[model samples]
Target: MASYKRHLNKDYTVMPNHHLRNKDLSLKAKGLLSMMLGLPDDWDYSINGLVAISREGRTAVENALKELREAGYVVIRKLYPNQTDSGIIEYEYNIYEFPQDEKVACQDIVYQEAHNQGTCFQTIENHQQLNTYKSNTYNKRNIKEIQFDLTGKEETDKCPDKSTPEIELEIDIYTYNVQIHDEFEELWKLYPNKKGKTNAFKSYERECKKKKNPAKFEEVKKGLIAYCEYIKATNTEIRFVKNGSTWFNQRCWEDDYTIQNGKNNQTNKKAQPEYELL
Candidate 1:
């Protein structure tokens, strides 16, 4: 709601290889974006300040600012007047916010999809006590009376003439507030050619193969499912039984949720290319 500024610290410096991790921008561009996000709506921060926050040196920060300006995420409105120096040029940036319409539309779809798949309830601060009671009730009794009735007209077709079974899974998920495990990233470094490796969740399979540890793969998958549950709700409880050997992936909401069985290689010959490009 309020504008904020990036702290001037070395930890925030943008690195070259990180650009590959977040395609569509060079390290400098990414640094500028981070700087803008760190600012509040009311404050007009100087270019020097932004550079200090995002880059290790002045030149790197300046270069990143130029790239961000070209990308249209930032604009140089006018020169900031430095009363003491007449020849000095200081550019004041007008940062842009993400398009609200697109973000709202995406969030709407996510909210609806989560509801249709399982149960998603919005949190009400005032009704926290009541909601916790209901959640506990729902968790303890498998009571059919108030359980979500997922039996409205099931959508058999997603696209024109493409019919797939209406799918549902009873899954208990927990999300963690930690960064993705470094082992997952290491797995990608090992099998850079694996399709869908760009997806953080799908990388688990390749990791298991590289380590030759099937048990570790299962552990990671379960941990991922728990992490997902954790992100969806606070003090969340997801209760579901996996009847057989099943796998849950650790993906962001946008990633597809398909399971690979008894396979260690990319199955889809024409799957999207692996790895993100900057």
Candidate 2:
């Protein structure tokens, strides 16, 4: 069934959709994650708290949380009672729009804990008896971060690289051909060149989030297929093919595609003649 036309003009939160598109997350988990992320940071985040706002029963909500946790979208920081820890003091739930590995997630937790430090973290001294250097808030806050370095050595203070660059093609996502939404991976698979997927997905998300005229996912699919065929039909080498990120950034699909006889165009080998787009 077709969706009712959406008018995305007001009262919207622009958030990343990596988790929404994640194949590992169940539909219920995805919906739950999306809803939780939409809440303000000061939300009373808990199992029952989410159940109060959602139609899902307690069991379903619990299951969704489990899925989110297993998928790395929901990270739980448990503060043990003491050195001989018996119970948790408080549970800190860290939610992410995108899944992250253990290493990055550990660092991410440090960043979060540091933001609310002194209240939650204590300066545990290491064997070297070296003074713990104060860290200014990595996200530009003036507050110092509580250092938890285990090496008895100072860690270099630096902000995490979280910026996803945006390319301003400024083209309407709607093309002449009408279509439905599909996964970004399909476009990745269809694209001949495979480099810069992280940025390629970012560009894909940019087009998908076009204010009122977001991209038709099928247009991306058709465009990728057409582009692939053009490359093959023209005997273009892989080296001559554009990177996935560059292709998306340039809005290459909007360009009129041309193709010629591979044999006849030996002299103008770099140029494409014309291929009728589907």
Candidate 3:
């Protein structure tokens, strides 16, 4: 996908490109803002409405909104039941073209009329409805996700960046407590030693960053395969096998390990990986 937007069609509306270029906003946040800009004026701007169509869950949307609001692209206002502000009716989200300073939302004529009448916005009809939305929550496979609209469909919690490669995509789940590369998972499956996977992955990621190249996944994979073979050929016991973390931490992939009558090991800086992953 194009990293930059181009206005090639008349059917589209234009928006500031700063959101795309903003160093502070994440990829998910940028996509969400672009989506909001594409929405029609009469469309539902409720949190639930936003959540329904998103591949991300409520938490992702909430965090993105918080970032946008702080950057001035979004303004959230609490609507009250009456002029006295005794009861909250609902929140009104005002999307802006530019970052706005902290101030009361500028209302349109229709909004003014509704507020002066001390009535809820057209979406929110009464106090009971407001309480219903606020009180309801659902257990989403162990994660407590707040349900703002009973009518909204479930969200998948996937990253919004469709342009990313599959390897990168797997690493960017952002939530649901998953943060390992597909290549590393493969390595884990092939390794003879199976301890401290969490630490191993952390070390794996750190090692990758040192190379700053994910394309070398094959190198790591081949290294693991060779190491596992060395263990089998040497008849190394499980208790004496090197931990996965130790393999990465010591950069053992460079070691020219061998079985000398099923007993000797060697090391060299120029040693190449042996054995294919499959």
Candidate 4:
């Protein structure tokens, strides 16, 4: 069996003097060319084939091929007539190679130019082929990759791991059954007549000012009211959280000890004594 050899050609379209100038070829184009030269001619490749090997999509492969063709290094024979599969076109490529003399001459001219610029090089031909090509001819070494398009694939929220545990939320509650009259009387006693009323209005105004974010305040207010209803139904304990930035008392409730003590104090002494005896 004949061993496959990737052929490099002299028909490169790059200006003869610029052939060895690495910047003359784009990284992707250089890579594609190198790959084409190294791979056996018997092996077939397409734009998609380059996309798969380069892990870059069709556009990248196309750009590389375009660059190679423009440089006159690679010739392509399109294998298929334009045909669409579900609205997408398909195509294949057959690349050609050229003589070696022109390849060496191209490399030589580039090396001499560089050598004149104070860049020292013992000899161009002696330089490692791949390294010399990469260092002198190609601008981009690393291939830019894009994710494969999976527009038509079905997806599910299935977890790969079965052992990951689920978590549950802890729900707590609090209740405040305040008597407005009693609180008003207490305020009157503390501030005295009109002064008490004035102070109360000022405090309310200040609180409203503190609750500057009306949206957040409204949200908290609704949540607090729901929380109050929960306490009324379930009688669970809840602590009020105040918005520090806004001086808004979003919600308030006594501690568990205070609640229990208050409940006990609200009960009749005789009833308490009877319950204790029981």
TM-score, each model?
0.23, 0.35, 0.34, 0.24
Residue-pair clash count for candidate 1: 12
Clashes of each: 12, 5, 0, 13
Clashes of 4: 13
| lDDT (tens digit, per residue) of candidate 2 on 179-252 | 11247776787888887777777677667645355666777677777777778887889887878777776556
Highest lDDT, which number? 3
After superposition of all CA atoms, the RMSD between model 3 and the true structure is 21.3
lDDT of 1: 0.34
Can you write out model 4's per-residue Cα lDDT over 183-231, one digit (the tens) per residue? 3344334321123244343333334323243222344344434434444
Q: Rate the local accuracy (lDDT) of all candidates.
A: 0.34, 0.51, 0.53, 0.32
Candidate 2 residue 223 C-alpha distance from true site, Å = 81
The candidate maximizing TM-score is 2
Error (Å) of candidate 4 at residue 137 is 32
Candidate 2 residues lying further than 4 Å off, grouped into runs, are 1-4, 80-88, 104-278
Question: On TM-score, who's better, 1 or 3?
Answer: 3
Ranking by lDDT: 3, 2, 1, 4
- Compared with the true structure, the alpha-carbon lDDT of candidate 3 equals 0.53
